[model samples]
Target: MRLPVRIALLLILFFCADLCFSYVQKELRPQTALQERDIPNALHPLVKQNAELLQTAALKKGITVVITEGFRSIEEQNELYRQGRSKKGNIVTYAKGGESYHNYGLAIDFALQKKDGSLIWDMTYDGNQNGRPDWLEVVSIAKTLGFDWGGDWRNFKDYPHLQMIPG
Candidate 1:
């Protein structure tokens, strides 16, 4: 083969290899990590503002909260729905694909952030020592910010979920 042709072929192979590696790396990342990383950029404007307020209010009450998920894609929602039914994990959600508010960028899932920076979804954890669970405190603050807590749902209590419905 000509030298120029060989060089071009080598560059093409390198580009293809690089693309594949990038895709593999992304696919290997934990789903929660991806969602958390995308939260700030993926949420709707009003939802984001309210989430910020909720976080601030929770903090003032000596509770440290973290948004674990925001603006879920339909594909991600489907994957969640499949859990327990078709997947190995326990069922985490009833909503599938477009059915959830997260698909519309209006929903967020939160967790408690301990002082050591570890996250927990324990609803009974009262890290703030305020006689009330920090999770409930965050929920109260979220409600004040116009977010509806999924924990209020009768059918499925998703304690981590909150969403704002537009008027």
Candidate 2:
């Protein structure tokens, strides 16, 4: 093949390879639909069902509540508890293993998002005056579905936390 012809073919082949790679990446990429893993470890079986119901209800309300964390093993619970107690940061979780409602599957952590995958999670309650407006927008929606808002806790207030009372 002539030098120019060979180079032209190479460029075309390179472009085709790139195109195929892009396509494959798009197809192989994990389906990040809802964060199923966000469900906390402490949820009770009935609470889990309540959470599922709330998830669907939130979708109908126009906010996408994604489960970002879920079920915890005793080991995971212990580690988390330890981290909270000894860590340099402020104390967080009070429940350890059997103490945590997570052991019973009664709690869940959820986030809101637009269609483009922009997460709406707040580490603290009403993080700012304008902070986590996204999270607050739907907290009530979850309550409407019968879940208690951790934000209301007189002590250990967790704005992002929600729990359901088994009906």
Candidate 3:
């Protein structure tokens, strides 16, 4: 084959491989069962459904949950990592893109709020005895809705985080 023609063919093959690589990276995870649909603001379906149900249940106990964060993009995660890598600001959260379930749209961070919308985030998970029990009932509601609460993580209980197992 002529050198020029061979080079052109090789360039085409390289471009196709690059495109395929990008696609794979974008879809590395299995299909998002509940994330791709059902959420009010682009939430994963299962996550949103269960979250709403849990929110409803919490209402019965006079607890209101405010979804503080949800569905972070890789770029957002990267930015967050930079901001949180330090111990300052009480270390709000610790997650990096592809490391956090949020990348798959299966996670959300929530906080209990009062009638006036003041955050009531329980600080007891970190041994702060002054925290309130407002979010405990929210946990019960989430369990009934089939969500795995990050609050139950043994090593690091995230009192304000809720997650999905995704059937």
* TM-score for each candidate, following the candidate numbering: 0.73, 0.59, 0.64
Worst 10 residues of 3 by lDDT: 123-132
Give candidate 1's TM-score: 0.73
CA lDDT, candidate 3, residue 6: 100
**lDDT digits (tens) for residues 12-64 of candidate 3:** 99999999998886565434443454433356788878777777787766677
As for TM-score, the candidate ahead, 1 or 3, is 1
Better-scoring candidate (TM-score), 1 or 2: 1
Backbone clash count, each prediction separately:
0, 22, 5
Tens-place lDDT digits, model 2, residues 1-167: 89999999999999999999998876443222112334444556776777787777766656577776656666777778787467665666876765554555666777766667777665443422444564765776678777778788767887667765454
- Which lDDT values do the candidates have, in the order given? 0.83, 0.66, 0.69
Candidate 3 Cα outliers beyond 4 Å, as residue runs: 1-41, 86-90, 123-132
Displacement of the residue 131 alpha carbon in candidate 1, Å: 1.1
